[model samples]
Target: MTIPYGYAKGTVISAPSLKPTRRDHETQYHLHFSVQVADEVWDVAVNVGTNDSDDLLKYKLVFDYRHPLIQTLQASPAGKNDLTDVNALPALDFVRSDLLGTTGRWRDSAVMDGSDTPEPVASLTRLIEKALSEKFDVYVFGRFYSEGNGIHDAHMNQGSKGRYIHRPNSDQNDHNAVWQDGAVLIDCRQPEWAAYFAAFEQQYLPTDDLGNPTPSSSPIS
Candidate 1:
């Protein structure tokens, strides 16, 4: 769990949208991108939410409009992702698990703001910023900030033990540069792509061989 599930392509140089944050105990929706890979320019972020809103319980967004990062973004060439590291895609905990093929859309963060709250994380942050304004293709994990690098634990890793951001503990404060957070979002455009994932009512569906989340303290349901 050293955070590193790569797959890149660039654009949106410094972010200007994607909001809906709470910070201190979670409720995310971050943004930031500067990807470029093969010529270096890494610095990404695309966090979705869950943590505040009472740990955002009662969920179900296992989407996958044809996952596999959308068949690798309809077979490459939009922002970039010809498989560049993270052991060649598929398994950085495979985007919130159940191995793609998801479909349970019914979300309910206890009526986040009532009024028939159908925000669905602001409708998937407007389809992940309409697939980041274009030239899409991005399925990152976390860590590796060679000066503000991005791609955070988008969501769910399992049985959090307290670290701060959605899950991470071990005395945090960068507990030797955190790891095993969670995330599984993809934003493509060719014929469609979107798999924004989220998980936190404090995770833990068994993990350990480096996938972290093997401990717990209960009370987060």
Candidate 2:
């Protein structure tokens, strides 16, 4: 995918790293990039893949700011004195886990709910805007996993367990109408960023066969 924002040129300053996961059978590979946009410093992670052959590809973009929730909590009276020291402040475990995969079930729950507030989609957009205004460097990470096969019944005695089951593929041309699913973050930190996003919506976002914004594929379950 083409990067829409054109603030400053970015460069890859670090090599990729491979790390072992807590799971005995799983491993992960991570790529890092240090970007210099104007005088600002930003870091990005790309192409994060897992050792699990069946895992799908995923991506994340992060910024260098305190988590909104933690910041809010720290301002409250009960947490005010307790978190006086920045180092002693309670870490926003939820945000950290979203960016760096963690074993806690919270991430899974967020994904399943679909309507969860403070969705990553909005967070990403906010980050872009903030970055543009402060000229802070922004980082983006992408990951991919092996697509899973179709669902099956629970039959303990079945000998076909190892066989590959075929599932329908997602239509590339379909654009989900839902805001969380359809919207892409546009670095609207600058006027150009807004224009870029507008152009993308007018040109590439999928439309119905009749040339409308409606999608023609099955809705995500």
Q: Which one is best on TM-score?
A: 1
Write one digit per residue (lDDT tens) for candidate 1, span 58-156.
344433356554564346554333222243344335334444345554355543432222445555555555555674555554444434444454454
Cα-lDDT of candidate 2 = 0.25
Tell me each candidate's TM-score. Answer: 0.29, 0.23
Clashing residue pairs, candidate 2?
45-141, 55-145, 55-146, 56-144, 56-145, 57-143, 57-144, 57-145, 58-143, 58-144
TM-score (C-alpha) between model 2 and the true structure: 0.23
The superposed Cα distance between candidate 2 and the true structure at residue 169, in angstroms, equals 29
- Candidate 2 wrongly placed segments (more than 4 Å): 1-9, 19-27, 56-221
Candidate 2, residues 14-94, lDDT tens digits: the string is: 432222233344453323334453344444332233445443223333222223333333233310011111221122111
Stretches of candidate 1 above 4 Å error? Answer: 1-4, 10-117, 125-139, 142-154, 160-180, 184-197, 202-216, 219-221
